[model samples]
Target: MSLAQWHNKRPPAATGLRLDFDDGGSEHVSTTTTSSALSLLSDQLATQFDRYKNEMARMFQDHVRIVDVVDRVDSLLAAGDGEAAPDCQREKEAEASNAARHGAELEERVARLRAEAAAWHPAVKPPCPSL
Candidate 1:
C-alpha cells in the first residue's frame, strides 16, 4: 500500500510510526520505543550543544584576557617611551650638579692646603745641594 493508504487505514487507537511501501510492505514501530529513542538522541544533542557553547565561551574569555594583557603592555611601553627622555634629562642634571659641588669642594681643599703650606716654617733648614 502507498503511504496515504496506510495513513488512512491506521486505527484511531494506534499510536506508532508506520512505514508503508507501494508494494504493500509495511513496518510499524511502537510509539513508546520511538519516543524513547528520540528522547535519548535529543538529550545527547543537547548535551553536546551545551559543551560546545561552554568551550566557545572559555575560548572567548581567554582571547579577551590576552587582548587586555596586550593592551596593558602597549600602554606601559608607550608611557615608558614618553617618560624616558625626561628621566634621562633629570639624571643628567643631577650628575652635573654633583660634579659642580665636588669640584668646588676640591678647590676649597686645595686652597686651604696651600695656605697651610705657605704659613708653615721648618724648625731646621735643610742643607742646600750644589749644582
Candidate 2:
C-alpha cells in the first residue's frame, strides 16, 4: 500500500498490535514503534560522539605538549649560541695578540743582527760591484 494510505490508517484497537507495512522497499515506522527505537539510537549516537570528542581532546593536548618541548629545545640552542659567541671573540683576540707579540720579537731580532753586522764590518767597506 502507498504511504498516504498507511499514514491515514487508524490505530488498531488492541494495545500491543504489530502492523507490518511495505511502502515500496522504504522503511516507514509508526509513532507507536518509533519512540523506543529512536530513544535507543539517540543514546548510542551520544555515547559514540562523546568518545570521539574525548579522543580528539587528548590528541590536541599531546600536540600542545610537543610544541612546548620543541620551543624549549630551540631556546636552549639559542642560549648555547649566545654563550659561544664570547668564547669565539676571546679566542680571536688572543690570536691577534700573539701575532702582534711575534712581530715585535722578530723586529727586535733583526735590529740586533744589523747592529752586530755593523760592529764586525771593517773601518772601510768595499763598494758593491756593477751588475
The TM-score leader among the candidates is 1
Over 4 Å off, model 2? 1-30, 82-131
Please provide, for model 1 over 18-59, each residue's C-alpha lDDT reduced to its tens digit, 9 standing for 90 to 100. 533433323333556678899999999999999999999999
lDDT of 2 by residue, 1-131 (tens): 89999899976454354434534332334564588789999999999999999999999999999999999999998989988899999999999999999999999999999998898886667988999
RMSD of 1: 21.8
Residue pairs of candidate 2 with colliding backbone atoms: none
Whole-model Cα lDDT of every candidate shown, in order: 0.82, 0.84
Q: Which residue segments of model 1 deviate by more than 4 Å?
A: 1-17, 20-29, 83-131
